[model samples]
Target: MTYFKVLFFTLCFLAFTTHAKEQPLKLDKHLSVFQPYLGSWQADFDVAPGTKPVQDVGLWERALNGKAIRTKHSINEGEYGGESMIFYDSKKDSLVFYYFTTAGFYTKGTIKVLSPTQFVAYEEVTGSKEGITKVKSTSDLKDGKLVVSTSYLKKGEWTKPESRIYTRSNQAVKFK
Candidate 1:
């Protein structure tokens, strides 16, 4: 009887271990990538001379059937950025990005996360001096700073996009 009991317990443990290993990753279908982005952000931009350097404030949230992340960014240098969508598609396992800017640009792309703190999204421009536009966004905690990036691109024969890094400079006020 003791031998049979030990055998049953061992089998049960092995079954549980196997099941845990095969568990599917869970994604919040109701949460767009934007939900993770909701918060105050500080931006430091690199600008050319004769053009004053720029910095800004921004807000983000989820939208569109809980399928996209949207951002509304404002600058102190007399320019305003409009809302944009960042969608995560589980079927293709990629982040679909789309944005229409008042500055006269409509761009789209897919985002691949290389790590929890690093990702790059890119697609092409369709009209009027067409080129591939890529944006690399990376975030990390450093001395409690929240950093992100929206890198620029000038596609010439499919060159890779550059990276942008943003660091949190102020105390984060939770709005949950």
Candidate 2:
């Protein structure tokens, strides 16, 4: 009788583990707009004209049992880095994200999906002493490349937008 009981328990454990392994990821349907960006990408661009180009590497992946999307990026081989986690907020009925940087600042933002290939983000900066209080960015994926443009609000004035184009890459994001 003891042997039979042990066998039954083992079979139950096996069944449970198998079910767990086969469970599907629960990503929110709203996140489908970001599907094309779910890989590593690299971009080289000057922060300002006439300056040396900085190399930025970024990686995007699903997180928190697919409830959120996590993005990690580094500039100039880890001279600067940041991580962002984006998830759907049921109360707000929108997708929101929090970004934390190595520079002792962070931003909270909302994303609006305009189309299958385009989205925009508006962020409120906190803990920045450089007088930057707001930021807006738009990303569009086209022809296997991603184009991102950003504008910064500094000291109550909005700056001109700058754009960058990124291509799929195999480089890993690193932090110093």
Candidate 3:
């Protein structure tokens, strides 16, 4: 009986180790969808609906051995800048992002990939001048241009979306 028990435990341990070895920690294949956005871009931010667009630049780079993508963006010539870390969460089966801004604000959001070239990110906002609580941002890439529309939730209703269009930068954008 003792010998049989020892054999059974050894087999179980070996089986567990083998299974663990087969599964390495890595990003999901769906991460390839972000490949097209892996460069530098320049865009303008609409201060309000149909208002003048403030110049901004965005840089996206692969980081952490391809496990995540990091974004650094400068708005209005460094009036405000932010960094975002985007990664796939295997446990949640979704893409997650954490954003920190120079204005002492932070947002956590999840990206729902609508397709390879389109995605929607819903964010919970805090520490803004208007006290915005929630925001929904939709992004689509077309003809080598990236367009993003963001809507804020106010009084249980989604407000008009502010849109921004970004074009690929042939030259690097420098921020102050």
Which candidate tops lDDT? 2
After the best TM-score superposition of candidate 3, give how far the Cα of residue 109 lies from its true spot, in angstroms: 0.7
For candidate 1, the per-residue lDDT at 172 reads 32
Misplaced by over 4 Å in model 3 are 1-28, 45-53, 154-157, 170-176
TM-score of each: 0.56, 0.82, 0.75
Candidate 1's displacement at residue 125, Å, is: 2.3
By lDDT, the better pick of 1 and 3 is 3
lDDT of 3 by residue, 55-84 (tens): 888998887877898899887667778999
In model 1, pairs of residues that clash are 146-168, 147-166, 148-166
lDDT for 60 in candidate 3 is: 81
Q: Candidate 1 has what TM-score?
A: 0.56
> In terms of TM-score, which candidate is stronger, 2 or 3?
2
Question: All models: lDDT?
Answer: 0.57, 0.92, 0.84
Task: Estimate, for each residue in 1-176, the C-alpha lDDT of model 2 and write its tens digit.
Answer: 99999999999999999998894454668776677788899999867787767999999998887789999999998999999999999999999999999999999999999988999999999998898999999999999999999999999999999899999999999999
Query: In model 2, where is the ten-residue run with the lowest total lDDT?
Result: 23-32
By lDDT: ranked, best first: 2, 3, 1
RMSD of 1: 13.2
The true-versus-predicted C-alpha distance at residue 59 of model 3, in Å, is 0.6
Return the top candidate by TM-score.
Answer: 2
